[model samples]
Target: MKKNFTLIFTLLLCLFYIGGNAQTQFWSDTFEDAGAPSSGSRTASIDFSCGGPPFTSYFTRTLPTGIALQNGSYSLFQGSKIWAAEDIDKGPTCTNASISANQQVTWSGINIAGKTGLSFKGLLAASQLGGWQGLNFGAAEDFLIVEYRIDGGAWTKALAFYSNVPAASPASSNQLYLDTDGDLIGDGAGLTYAFTEYSANITGTGTTLDLRFNCFANASAAQELAVDNFRLFEAPPVVAPTVTTTAATGVGAVKATLGGNVTADGGASVTERGIVWATTANPTTANTKVTNGTGTGSFSAVISSLPAATLVHFRAYAINSSGTSYGSDLTFTTNAALSATTSQSNVFCNGGSNGTATVTASGGVTSYSYSWAPSGGTSATATGLTSGSYTVTITDSESTQITRNFTITQPTAISTATGSQTNVSCNGGTNGSASVSPSGGTPGYTYSWSPS
Candidate 1:
């Protein structure tokens, strides 16, 4: 019978194990290439007769809520084709597509059926950088935005800046970002996004041109910021960017020291501000934080309490006024715990000297302590045992300790001797005698007598 029961239990366990291996299900969508659409593939036919550079109206959905700039033949605003120094630079005169307050302009249009969006491209001179400062974008309080017109209806704001950002540096080097890996917003400096296509949702378009670059405090004068290759097209399926953990060492714990760089192309960042740890990739936003956002750009945390054998994964992120920018993920592991804990099942029994038992510990214990109480225990080197309640405590080399508790019960006493018997002959003939006794209690006894 016992063998049959064991076999049945094992078969049930096997069935449960097999059930756990069920595969997860998922689905995906595909789209035609924007670069070269094949037969039956939808492509925006653009006419450069208005100016140079062909326009591709692939992304036609309304832009996300942010600022935008337009150039090339698709520019909705007049005079956008010409590049002039006095039109969009810092100094008194703004020039080029880098709109400045001095040359402020607002363009508006309708989407009017068909996926006809907008597009533009140009170059910005490295010198024209406002350094860490940028020209005002859209309204001061609101994000700079690109609005689209669908079916000739009212315009709506599209595309806005995201949160993550890289440290601000002088515009000394040129950089490029494409939508291939992710959204093509320039790493930290610029960004790009697409809208849904084919839907009658979009008709015409317009853009707010207020964001421009101004010189930093230390500047000789104004420089040129250029822009070009702008267009709207059918939105495409976004690819998830790959995230990897890279650290100074594989050590789980990171030390507080001079700062280092963590990089990722498609927006990346460490989730929190304090020192945090995890064995998984892409930890949620709650795991870590270094300095609690003092704006010092330093990442540090305290984690001496964690076990040495455990591993830690970390990532860094930068938050711009708009949204979050993420960096690559990093990972490390600790040595292991200096000590561990063990527990014994709670025990209940009748009060008796034979109830005593010793718990054996495998790990070498440096100090053996004990505790005893009705329902609780304390830490002490040795504990004298009693009846009603008891507990044990043990401390290890790591200064960590564990406690266990048990209880003892006493049986009720029974009464014999009937009603009091009257004294027969003389003083107290055959005086009634009564006695009381407790089991598994103190070994001593005392008594008192009274006359009736």
Candidate 2:
């Protein structure tokens, strides 16, 4: 009873496991709380725009001490808490919600004290939004930071810049750079600056993405940065896939054998690779049908029973973000069935004995038919065949045939003969002719007589 119960439990578990893996149809991303600032949690603190709310909250440190928010506006003064004495002029004014010459504000010391730099970053979940144009930071002079986070963890710096200078002047390029190779700040003089663009490849499960920015201040603090244009808009997604096949030996089956490899890349995998057959001599196509498994990188399937004259073909394909990629067709053929043969030793006879001939079939032949013709006569096994030339033809079940021919000669038997003289050849004079008779092998023959 216990054994039966255990078997039932195992079967149930297997069914449950298989049922849980529903095929994924459309891909999607889990929505994330994108409004948070570069630092603070409850209210996004990173000041996306140089002159906006939820702005300074995103900043860890700000320059020009006496910085304050009044009536939805910020005031910057040399003596203010967020300000420094080196600020060229005290409070710059934002009139009609527009930045004027004096309204320009820079956050210094952001990169100083070993604090993480500021950046502007963007995130797009595959499931959520589509048809995004591109991401834009403020003009070059704004000297903003752009950074991104994967699956919402720590903020990694993406790009950084210095003040493009002369606010309200023609725009210059943003400056962003790493410290040569290390993360630590290098010597203050001649430090490389640049505005960088970065891309992230997401794999597995998590979908939420995060971004932040740090605005650098002026030369006064040598520690500040600035921020501008903090917002999120969709950007085009990325696509690239790789396809490869496994190592294979030369096809050896009399009938074409099918085999293949696996595919990857472009966020896709192989569903099937098709194989087919053809019959034309040196045929590229024609009378073809899929012989192996379907779709994807690697798989194997027989083309069913094939004739010796068949030529087979193979092709592969994969589905990815960019649609399907097709592989070039390759072909191999079922080698023609061959017939092989071996010759039997020559037949030797002593007087009038009989002789026989024998031959063997090789290769793919299941059965063999043999016929022989001799210098003497034709026979199935060629028995009692007198000494003479002979030939044998063998046919295989496949109908392929081959022939061998040889010669046979018999040695003559020893001969014994006797001779007699007629009546009387008395006293040395030959009266009558002597006669001789021969028997065996040489038959009746000639003879000569001499008397002394």
User: TM-score of every model?
Assistant: 0.25, 0.32
Candidate 1 residue runs with Cα over 4 Å from true position:
1-272, 284-291, 303-310, 322-328, 332-383, 393-402, 407-452
Q: For candidate 2, lDDT tens digit of each residue in 174-206?
A: 222222332232111221211112222222223
- Which candidate ranks first by lDDT, i.e. highest? 2
Model 1 CA lDDT for position 303: 38
Residue 27 accuracy (lDDT) in model 1: 12
lDDT of all predictions, in order shown?
0.31, 0.36
Where model 2 places Cα greater than 4 Å from the true spot, the runs are 1-144, 161-205, 216-407, 417-452
User: Tens digits of per-residue lDDT for model 1 on 1-452?
Assistant: 33543454456446533643221111101221232111122221111111112211111111111112232111211112322221122222222222222331122231212222232112222221222222222121111223343433454434322112222232433222211222322233442211111111223433322112121121112222222212333222222222222354423222322122323222223332333345677654565544334232444333344444655555654443334434466656554333334333222233333333244433332444444444333444222333455656655544445655455444333233333444456665765455455343233434455663
